[model samples]
Target: MSSKYSLPLVLSFTIHIVLAGILLLGDFSSPPKPTPTSVQMEPIQAVIVEKSKVEAQINKIKKQKADDAKKLKDLEQSIAAAKAKRLNEAKRVKELERQRKKKAREKKAADIASKKAKAKANAADKIRKQKEREKKQADEAAAADAKAKRIKEENDAKKAAKKAEDLRKKKAAELKRKEQEARERAAQQKLLEQQMAEDMANRQQARRQQMMTEIGRFTALITQTIKRNLITDRSTMEGKSCKLTISLAPSGFVTNVVTGQGNRIVCEAAKTAVYKAGTLPVSKDPEIFREMRTISLTVAPDKFN
Candidate 1:
């Protein structure tokens, strides 16, 4: 039992022990003595008086029993009041403990909820940052591709222009080469024409000189033919000299024969001998005709030998 209940039980037990000691020590050895009478003896009255004393004693004893019963009832009521007060105090303490536990549980649940909300917000922020980075990279790639394409186009245009200029220069060089070749050909042709004209003139000059030199051979031929036709009579002298001039046509026919210086008989004999030959000997060369058309002849037997 609790200390409060134990203290009340000890107090009740101590009071019971004191009441028992009082009962044990009180003297119950003789009844109350009869009230004393005067020293004169009366038998019947004395008996009656003794009986009255006994009845009075019995009445007092009954009254004492009633008082003891009321005291016992009062003690039992005090014990019940003490037990009720202890039971109410125990109930109040139990109710306070239960409220304290409930508050602790609510605080723990609220803390868990707050942590979960924070974690969700952090996840959303991370996703947004990743998307932004990806978009930035894609935009940079597109811009780079466009710039590369433009550079390639400009390079192609420059290459085409360079090719065209090179071709034009090549054509111009070819035209200049052809013109130079044509000029060379014209100069060569003019030189060839001048060389041909000089060669023709040299050939003609050589032929004229050759024909003039042949005149001596024609003179010899004429002298021999007239000597073969000599009809020398003994009357004509042997050592006489004769000179003659002969004329001829292109056909070598004697057109005229005349005596220049000699003895009369010898000159006359030479003229007759030339006529007897019917034609004088001359070169057939057209160039020699200029010398042979008219010729001079001398006949001295000593010199002609």
Candidate 2:
């Protein structure tokens, strides 16, 4: 049969052969000898003698065989049971080992996948950060360039403004100079006309002396008049002389009077007296009139005081 049952079968056969050999040896060694009889045997006694020994031996062998067979049967049963148990245990251990190996493989695969995913994520993050840094740098550079451009533009505007202002100032100065020159030329022309007219009349020297004398006489007359018309204390008017310049029109009427240095009331009275004189009794020469119309007079009330 199978290798597993071979040993039990061989052991049962060996036990049976040993028991049979013992029985055969016992029959050969104890063969039945002639039975000594005291008297003639009965027929029933002969029969009993002839079969009794062999029958008793056969009965004994039968009982031993029955006991051996029961022991062999019990032994075979126990061995079969042990083999069944060992086989079941081996199968269970193999199944457990297979499950363990499968679990280990799954765990290893999961670990590898996780590591790859983590590496990929790290790489992506690194690239993103690098791009961001580059973008930031570019922005900074652009801003710097923009700032420089703006500063340059501002400086250019300021320079243009300054240049325009300088031009305006130069133009204003040129106009002012031209106006001053024109005014000087007009004054010179008027002086030349007066000189020419005096020369034509042939009374230039005499007219000048007469005009000087008349101006002096008028000044003395104004001083006396102011002294006489004093409404204030005479001592107050005694200290200073009132000098004035009066402008007259060609018709000899006073056009304007400017006080040089004098008390306010005395200057006012002197100006009024000069106005009352209307036209001075003098030559009508244009040369003389031109000088006399713009005369300087001093009214010193103190001189008459």
Candidate 3:
């Protein structure tokens, strides 16, 4: 079957065929001739030699078979090792695929969460802006109301001031009119009194003129008597003419004497002569006495002078 056993079997069969042919061809005669003496070749001894050679060949074939068996076992071991290595590579590829899928799932979830958070923040900011806008509008409205109230108050104050000023002016004008009317009444009363007094004075003046002529004659008589009574060293009584006024009671007695236009010496002499007479010759009428209490006269030593 194997090349090692088949090669050894072919060589042994060919050697036996040749040894038999030589025996059959006359090889025994040649040996017998050399042994004309009868030499006995043992059949048992040939069988023993053939058996020994076959045993030796069998031993060699067994050794070769053992060596071949060992080589076959080694080749089987190498094939099993290569199959195990391929199985390990396939498992490693599967694990790497699983890891990649897991990582992709985690990244997708994170992106979704981030989008939601951003949206929530945007909504909060929008609400804040709306509230601010409302507050600003309310403040503006309040400010406008306050400003209007202030303007109204100022207008009312101006109207009140104008009303007060007008009332004051009207009161002042009324007081002035009353004062003017009072002064006019007083002036009219005074004018009426002055007119009545002037009428009474005119009647009294007519009687006083007649009584003054009579008193002048009596004064002349008294002067003549004093001139006769007196004696002087001087020859001429040269002096200025004197006029005098006299105030008297109704009884014609002198109350006081006043010189009008004369020297002091002549007036004193005239006054003394009137005193010696003791009473002036005046008007008998009471009305004439009231109007003629004062009189004026002139005196000189010589009549012409």
Candidate 4:
């Protein structure tokens, strides 16, 4: 038999033995107490006793005892078997409970592992998104900086080009003015040479030409001086001209200047320029004085005010 059923079988066998002893002892307990007796007259007769009848009574008693012992032994064996069977059922129930508890623990462990894995995945996704956002912002910042730098470079280049163009125009105008002055001087020198060679042929014509030559040279010098001092406002003096009557001393110093005719603003600008010059060019030749003193000079400019 299985070890778990051994104790219950033993206990059942002991209980059956105790019950059989109680039944046998109850049946043969000390003879019952003697009953009361009374005397009586009786007829006497001769009685015959048989040997075979006595032997048969003895054999019947022995057979009854053997059957009782056999019944008792069968009862003990049946009780023991029933008890062992009950103990086996109890063991089956306990084994099933242990299996149930083990399965429950395994399932709980699996659930915990699943939850941990899911949590890790969620954390990783959050970090990835954060890194992507930071990278996108960095890229946008770099692009904006590049755009601003390009705009600044283009503006600087435009300013440099405009400055160069203005300088080139200024230099060209200066070169043109010098060439014009040189040509005028050459013409004046040729005229003076022509008049010197023919002085005896026409004294009056030669004298007039000489005076004209002196006047032209002095006027050109005065124009150059005034041009340097003049500050023009195109809005005020565009397409305007003026005549100035100037009284000069023999020493090339101007004593007075008066506006003759033209726009008032143009005349005022011209007078201011003449005064700023402080003096006019004068010929040392006394004969040139008649035309130089109290002269009316036209102040006109085509390119500048």
Candidate 5:
């Protein structure tokens, strides 16, 4: 029998035994007080007791005790089976709880794993996007650099062309300026030469005029002196003239005299008078003196006193 039912079964069996003992011992308990005997004179009769009937009654009591014992044994067996069934049910319930806990733990672990996988996938996607962004930026930067380089090159080319053109223009202007300067120099040189020639001609002309004036004045003095010394006979020399050439030194000393194309008497008189004067008026200036050194004169004896 299961221990759970053993105590109750034993207690029930013990209570039945105690009830049986009470019943058996109830006759031996102190006898109740004796009732008063009745005094009646009645004739007594002899009765035969049957031994088979009494034996039959004793056997019936023994059979009833055995039936009760059988019922108690059956009750103990039923209680033990019920207790065993309860223990089995409890074990079944405990096993079901264990399985439920295990399933819960596995489900929780699965959820955690799924979440971790999703997180890893998200992280990878994020990294990929970051890389794409960086690559796109790099491409944009490269394109910008190329464009800038092209623009710079174009600007440099334009600047170079402009510089060359400017240089050409500057050189052309410089050459033109030099040519103009040369022309101006030539014109100035020609002008200077012309001015110098004009100045020289003017100075020469003035010097000649002054020399002629001096020569004329000195020539008149010589003629007057020759006339004063003339020993002419006016009656024979009237309306007759002679031309005489006289030579003089720088100091007015007479050097020589010759007569030309005139009456011989008049010419002789004039030449003799010129010699008699001993000296003639001459110029002190070298140029005027050169002209006066040999001078020609015309003399006529008319109304001489």
Candidate 6:
């Protein structure tokens, strides 16, 4: 079946064809010749010699066939051995290829893992740096705001203090002006009071002088009335006067008469005359009449005669 056994198989087939041709063309012999000396013995002897030579040639051909078959069997065994060796070599090559592929895959996987780890580490470092920068910026902004607020508060406090001082000075000036006005008003009031007191005293002295003159005029009129009504005896009443006290009503009606130290005769006569004259002259003004309600007089009848 294999090409390596082609020549051996062709050679074996040719030797088989040659052996069949030799068996088919076996030795041919002529009929036995008759001999005169011993007729039976010579012919029999010749036939036996021919048969033995043919048998010997047949034995030689069988031996050659056996040898060729033995050689063919040995060739087939050699070819089987060579086929087995080639199969074993192919199996060894396949196993080596599988080992190489597995090692290559393992190396590729390791390289990919290393790259991924490096990328992750770089990303984490970048994020941390960014956070630190943001924190620093926030702290700076807060400090700036605090400084501005402090400055504004200081300015406001100064303005408030200055305004308060201005208000205090204005109030003090107003108080001083009011005090000066009060002192001027007090001096004017004192001068006016002194002038009013002098005018009142001068008016009172003039009123007293006028009231004294009116009182003297009324007293002389009353004495003249009494003397006109007296009963006089000139010899005994000459140079003798009578003193009398009289009480009168609001309309000048004589109520009662009392005699005081004087001439008894003239006093009796005067008392009778006053009773006869029931009414007398009186002032209509209330202040003038208060002085004449009770009056004392000395009447002398000799003067009337």
Best prediction by TM-score: 5
lDDT of 5 at 158: 100
> What is the per-residue lDDT of model 1 for residues 1-305, given as tens digits with 9 covering 90 to 100?
57767888888888777655544443362265746778766699877888888777766655555555566657767777767777777777887788788888988987998899788878888998998899889989988998999999999999999999999999999999998999899889888878887887788778766776678777778888887887775546478878888899988899998898788888888788889998877888876987789888776654444
Q: In terms of TM-score, how similar is model 2 to the real structure?
A: 0.27
Candidate 3, which segments miss by more than 4 Å at Cα?
1-128, 182-186, 189-305
The lDDT leader among the candidates is 5
RMSD of each candidate?
58.8, 45.7, 55.1, 46.9, 55.1, 56.0
Name model 4 segments beyond 4 Å from true: 1-201, 303-305
Error of 3 at 89 (Å): 77
Worst 10 residues of 6 by lDDT: 25-34
Q: Give the TM-score of candidate 1.
A: 0.33
lDDT of 5 by residue, 255-290 (tens): 899999988999999899988999887877888888
Error of 6 at 76 (Å): 99
Give the lowest summed-lDDT range of ten residues in model 1: 21-30
Clashing pairs in 1: none
Question: What are the models' TM-scores?
Answer: 0.33, 0.27, 0.30, 0.33, 0.45, 0.41
The total number of steric clashes, by the backbone 3 Å criterion, in model 2 comes to 0
**Model 6 residue 117 distance off true place after TM-score fit, in angstroms:** 30
What are the runs in model 5 whose C-alpha is more than 4 Å off?
A: 1-165, 303-305
lDDT of 4 at 232: 74
lDDT of 4: 0.79
lDDT (CA) per prediction: 0.79, 0.74, 0.66, 0.79, 0.83, 0.78
